[model samples]
Target chain A: MNVPRHWREQIRRYRLVGSKCTDCGRLSFPNRAVCPKCNSRNNENYQYAGRGKIISFTNINSPPKEHKYNLPYAVALIELMEGPVITAQITDARAEELEIGMEVEMVTRKIMEYNDDGIICYGYKFRPIVEYAHP
Target chain B: MKPNKSVGIIGYGAYVPKYRIQNTEIARVWGNDPNLVPIREKSVPGADEDSVTIAIEIARNAIIRAGINPSDLRAVWVGSESKPYAVKPTSTIVAEAIAATPFVNAADWEFACKAGSETIQACIAFVGSGMAKYALGIGVDTAQGAPSDALEYTAAAGGAGYIIGSAKESLAIIEASISYVTDTPDFWRRQHEHYPKHGNRFTGEPSYFKHVLSSSKALMEELGTKPEDYNYAIFHQPNRKFPLEVAKILGFPKEKILDGLVSPYIGNTYAGSALLGLAAVLDKAKEGDKIFCTSYGSGAGSDSFSLEVTDKLAERKGKAPSVKSYIERREEIDYAKYARYRKKIRA
Candidate 1:
């Protein structure tokens, strides 16, 4: 929540930057120093294009202290089209409407704001791509 | 004054948050009939969205439509009144999000509704000077409306982004642009104020209409063009009626401006108002089509522009979602959720 820690992970948080194993061409959702597939240190930074499908989801009614503002929210495990799965908070849709395999796209949003004067953390969240088109 | 250099909108994009609250819903909470307000519904930002996020989405779409590298953008200028931070720059955040940081002229602008067009004017000069190949101008806002006030029915969340570059690579050439401003205290919000105040009846005749007509007529006169010459016209819409009324006064028929009048569907996006209208028109324009646009801001002024669609427009436009697409991808929300999203009910 402080400056240095939040600032250091901004690119990964904002852009969904993950690591791709250069050895076996496998991708990891959160970038790690070592490749998960080949156990090799050779990895490349791969920025996910932010579009994917919801593999699974959960409805959170009792949230942590900071997230009490959003009384009921949905969190989903999304499988990015490029082959990495990440957990993200879903927006613009209610929990009752969510279903497995619903398509979604990432958008930048405020993760949390401690207070009016405190640092606001911005990160990626996914929204349903319902009745949407890409050309 | 016409710039010596030929600058035009090479790539353009627009964004509207997916959630919408009907005017009837707001009226229901206030003990009034919602059908009376000009707009049918208004777009609302989700709890996590703000001017910065809206601008980032628009800038990303513009980058896609422009088919240019983010590194090639020489500047990223964002114009808005509903900035997330009182001190930090929205432009820098937008630039960094689009990966255009490190070598760009970035800044924030304010002029109420016309703030976005003000960026267009600045971008014209930036690219006209030949300082860079491309620059971006975006008008965005998560407009604030006091609970139960009339402005609440119309002030909404949305944005439009445009990429300005050489005429040769442009989708729409900027033939001419001019501004008309005056010392009018028609609408304003003081420091620390949560919402804006308007001079009611005075916001019309003396502020919105006067400046819009004055700048629009002058721009046409300077270009030596008539209303009949333009294939399309766009005007600032504070509601469903203002733009149409102004369009009629300017001698533009109802049909020419209808395609671009997005306010009736999404409410007034403040800084994004007229710029979003223009973006809608550009989405379907054909080569050689002429478009005239005018944007008005409270405090109060109007920025007018004349543009012509180029051959590249038809091909490059489809790369990103159209304004119509953003408008249609909506999910209606009740007043309770809307209040929570806008944070009207503080814990």
Candidate 2:
């Protein structure tokens, strides 16, 4: 990706800023301009809580050209708490450790390097949420 | 220097990569004895992790612990030696990641290893002067060491962050601080140099020890306190031995430095070393306890602070995961896998 494209995706990439349909209460990632489900134009900017579960995942042993450095990485369909499903790369855990319905949280990470001397694109990734007990 | 408005750490956080490579693995790769390892294991950032990503994780934890709106942050400072880009400021990325943009002053700082502590000093000054209600200071790095070099054993990745504000809203109060710097070139990395070079034993006497000792003594003398007066003492740990030796020389018992001597497990986090140690100590310290912290950077210099735990510390302790939890939550990898994670070999 070039500089402009990286800049354009910054808000959704960093803050999990998406769109929630006011008419049907459906959440959509990438901050959709219109609701996909109900074909409603009534949508508000929504910020996801970033808590989600792994719906399905696949191990990318052979990655894309830009991401070839990270071999055998996992990409997953995450069902967010706000009722939107988004596809993202999973990190901080091995492929063997990932399972369906595992809880995860969003974290910012480098998505890919554009070239040897070009811009580096960064975006959100998911990590398993280890349990922390509070009294 | 004592802040006029009594500024202190309102909240703190730390982040170490989940991937760790055992010292034995490095020793095996370099054809050396595992017994000669300086640390047990060192954190390694994944292919997608860098200084900015690490800072964002720790900053998020600090924000959670501070229990304040991200927009409340008036400034954000990140100190590191291994920023992702040379010209662009890492602080801007961090500020935007934490959603503290548009009105906050943001910049990147470099002072070798002590840069993180420098961020703390700047934050204290900003809030103490009442120019900002809150400021975030982060010391983070994905430090680089040349392959098979001695620096490889201990130059690791990790960092800690602090949110500084009024003492009234703090879990711990900074009573005083002092800094000692000189034009010593004990360690340095030139422009475009991928890895840093050190002056062998030169980094020891005329740099690390001298600066750390001078700064710590000066802060203690100014505060009219003794080694025994502080409940805990945290010194920059380049290895397991440096902090212990410094503690003994300064008349502090080994037990006082135990909680903060974290380099043994995480390796030297460069700018993050001493500050991470202080965070670990704060994780277990009690109210009314005193802590003496001194950080050494290789250029070289030291920044020392004397802090006192407050009654509010207990309430804030559970706001985020403790330093111990981060350390305990690790998954070790072998040398080949480590090399891939660190990008030691080109894809």
Candidate 3:
């Protein structure tokens, strides 16, 4: 079963949200209700600029039954500027285009969905944030 | 008189094979759509990989991670229902590979998914009794069942290890533990069968949830702790969703269960799942924080424990393989390869 195109697109271009701990000053993606460090319920309001660096990655040529849409895609650990590591799909780049500590930014995208029902699931992904020279 | 000797983690490690099999391709091959099972990818064991090799790998990492001398270990125990040989002691092979000579007390344990935690508990008992200075508890398996068998999507490969000793003499301390046992047959693998038989609905209420909740509640009550006190909660996950539902019922919030939820995407590593999730939580958990863990096995039993983060745990974060590092180190195997490995198709 194939994921609906729209969800794939939505997830291909998604945004990731996270919070930084005010106590230990560590970053947590997807937000934490309590600080794992100091046990503080008080969260320091911060959204990841969605920009990060790749720490490591792998190309998954095979996925699970529910994730038919994704094949031969790069899954990586992205270190957000906030200091927490995140696992997400790397887009707009092939297997060879990635490296450890490479700069990246989160993007919105469609991941998988109920194909026949057309219920799409969206998620945040990372893409290489390349620097370009002003012509 | 000295306080009850607290058990501590003296060594630790884990193993995830290089290959990954997509759940979707597996569904397609089985004449069903991917949606039949909500799985993403599963770790595939290599040609040479088995319960024994995986345990050895984790044991090596644990030894390296703990920085303890192999000869210092007095006992070795390998825990898994997926043992490679019927009569051979897998622990002996693991001990030899890690160079932990002449095991004073070495054995293999099996209790379905709870085998790993059970080994830890046994090691704790051994070390606390002064029968040994250091004992190794390793859990590793490459669980297999037929495709679209409900077990298919989540029966992945992985393993975890822990070295136990005195608190003053080790890594993470074991604060308290409680266990509950019942004779409910939620899951069972016969004398010579590769796959387990499960009563799904029965597993949910009468077995998995029941025993885990009973044991965890008893542990918390005995320790005078509450659900809100834990920084993280690690549950024996047969899949990603079961843990969350169990947590919700137990009054733990979603955030408390997120780290462990990674198993759904990674697939059910059986004995490795809960411990691996705990490893991930420990990576980011701070000193003095508490972690509540529960382990469940299919013949129906659970062991619940209260764990507090120690200064030692903080100092040892980067010393071993990081959870993210292990998850990223896998090679993806397609449906065909998965079928072959599962032995669904004969060579």
By DockQ, who's the top model here?
2
lDDT of candidate 1 over A9-49, digit per residue (tens): 88888778888888988898789899877899999998788
DockQ of each: 0.47, 0.56, 0.01
Which scores higher on lDDT, 1 or 3?
1
True contacts kept of 3: 0.00
Query: Candidates' TM-scores?
Result: 0.96, 0.97, 0.71
Most accurate candidate by TM-score: 2
Kindly give the number of clashing pairs for every candidate. 0, 0, 30
lDDT of 1 by residue, B119-155 (tens): 9998998899888889999999999999999899999
> Which ten-residue region of model 1 chain A has the weakest summed lDDT?
A126-135
Worst 10 residues of 2 chain A by lDDT: A126-135
* lDDT over C-alpha atoms for residue B342 of model 1: 94
What clash pairs does model 2 have? none
Clashing pairs in 1: none
Give stretches of model 2 more than 4 Å off. A37-40, A133-135
lDDT of 3: 0.74
CAPRI accuracy category, model 3 = incorrect
